[model samples]
Each structure stands twice: as C-alpha cells, then as structure tokens.
Target: MPDAPPSAAPVEESTEDWRRRNVGRLLNEAVRRFESRVLERLAEQGFHGVRLAHVGVTRNLDVAGTRPTELAYRASMTKQAMGELIGQCVDLGLVRREPDPADGRAKIVRFTDQGLHFLEHFRRAVVAAQGEMGENLGEERVRALLETLWDYVHPDGT
Candidate 1:
C-alpha cells in the first residue's frame, strides 16, 4: 500500500515545560515577582505614587544625579520619554532639575529630600525581597543566580 499523508496539526508544547525551560521567560518572571514585592513594600511604606513604569528610569538613576539624556540612554529610552518620567517625578516632589554646571543649556536631575526618603524605602524593600527569594530558593542558589546575572550584565567587569 502507498504511504498515508502526514498529519496537518502542529505539535503542542507543554506550558509548564516551556515556563521552566525558557531562560528569558524565567528571568522576566523573576524580575516581575521581585518588582511586585518591592512595589508592595513601597506602598506599605506610603510611597503610593511610584509605579512600575517609573522604575525603568528611577532604578537606573545615578546617586549623584545625571542629565536627562544620560538617564534616557542608560534606561534604553528616548530623551522625550525620560523627560516625561522626570516631569512626573518632579510633580511627585521626588526630583528637581537644575542647570548643569558643565553645560549651561543642559539640566541635571537630582533627587529631593523626599526622593531620598523614597530611595531608602526602596533599598529596604529590595533587601527584604532578596531575603524572601533566598528563603524560597536557598541561599547558595540565590547567590549563584545573582553572581551569574552580574557576570552576564558586566561581561568585562566594566
């Protein structure tokens, strides 16, 4: 007899297996979970205005302050997008813009006292989140994961 035709239906992948095996998805889920914990803690501490979207710029911000262009570049965003986020931060009284000493036409964004307070809260929340992650994943695994991520992010130690 002649060979029958092949099946037309595509093979399906198990969602659980995919979730467990995809490195990008795993990393993204981990980040989401961590950010959720941090934001929840921030909310508990009365930092109600901060949102997940704000984190892209806020977390990348330099402690000594930086220009909008630089912040935008670091956050992998455009200057206009960074400017909008900065305006929101200004309205929230978290940051303020001052003329840059090195360049008269450019402005540097610096955290206000209120912003400093928020940063302290964020630091605490991050520590708490890390502790929780360690409790769930075990200390050694968590440390290894962090070290691996650090190496991935800074390949040449730069």
Candidate 2:
C-alpha cells in the first residue's frame, strides 16, 4: 500500500485524557441522558407507552400532518421502519392515518385528540427536562448549548 494521507494517521491509544471521552461519545451520552429524562417525565404524565424511539416520529411530525415517507426522511429512517412505527403509534391512539386530500392514494398521519393532548404533555415534559438540565449545567449554559445545537441542526430554519 502507498503512504497514508496526512489526515489518515492511526488513532492513538485511549488514555486518561480526552481520547477516552471524545466529542462523539460525550454528545451521544449526553443525548441519551437527556432522552431518558424526557421519557421519565412522559411516564410520570401517564404516557408510559411513549419511548425514546417515538421521539423520532413526534419530533419530525408536522403540525398539520405528514406522510410516512416524509416522516421517515426527516427521522433518517426507512419507509418500512417508519410505517411500523406509525402502526405502533396508531395502536397507542397517538396518531391516525387519514386519506390525503391532495392525493387520493397517499395517506397523511395526524395526531389524534389523545395525541394532541399528549403533545401538550410532551412539551411540558421537555420543559421540565430542560429545567433539570439547567439545574445541572446552569440556565445560561444549557440555553446557549440548545441554541447552538438548534442552529446547527436546523440551518435551513425548517
């Protein structure tokens, strides 16, 4: 093989320094912790069926409604996977698939009345979770971090 590129140097051993707790690991751990807290709050609100996986659908759901394919795209999932999740949500009475008016063959997934209520509860749960994070990281730091992440993720203002 030819020589490796300048940026392709072999990774060093993980010591007691930052290598052991790299950015990706730190971010993933923090997100899991945050999601766990949010799920706990949801459970407290009697939405025990809601899990972290459900967030992938709810987070990307449009206010009016959305197609399963669109939700899959937004959630970085496949249509089949999203369809299964949609079925699960429907079973839980969190959403319903209605015939799309614009396209007779297409279906639009919209939150049910129960789901609308759950959305309000979910919002409050998120606020409570953020409060907990703020308590740990200080209000300013947490908000700043959220702002940075929001900007980074929604660069197109979607």
Local accuracy of candidate 2 as per-residue lDDT tens digits, 45-144: 8999988878788888887999999999999989999999989889889999999999999999999999999899889988998899999989999989
What is the C-alpha lDDT profile of model 1 across 1-158, one tens digit per residue?
A: 95333333432574344434456765787899999999999999998889886767678778789999999999888999999999999998888999999999999999889888888898999999999999999999999999999999999997
- In candidate 1 the C-alpha lDDT for residue 73 amounts to 92
**Clashes per candidate, residues 3 or more apart or on different chains:** 0, 0
The candidate that wins on TM-score is 1
Q: What lDDT does the true structure give each of the candidates?
A: 0.85, 0.86
Model 2 CA RMSD to the hidden true structure, in angstroms: 7.2
Q: RMSD per prediction, one decimal?
A: 8.3, 7.2
Give the TM-score (vs. native) of candidate 1.
0.85
Q: Give the runs in model 2 whose Cα sits over 4 Å from its true position.
A: 1-19, 154-158
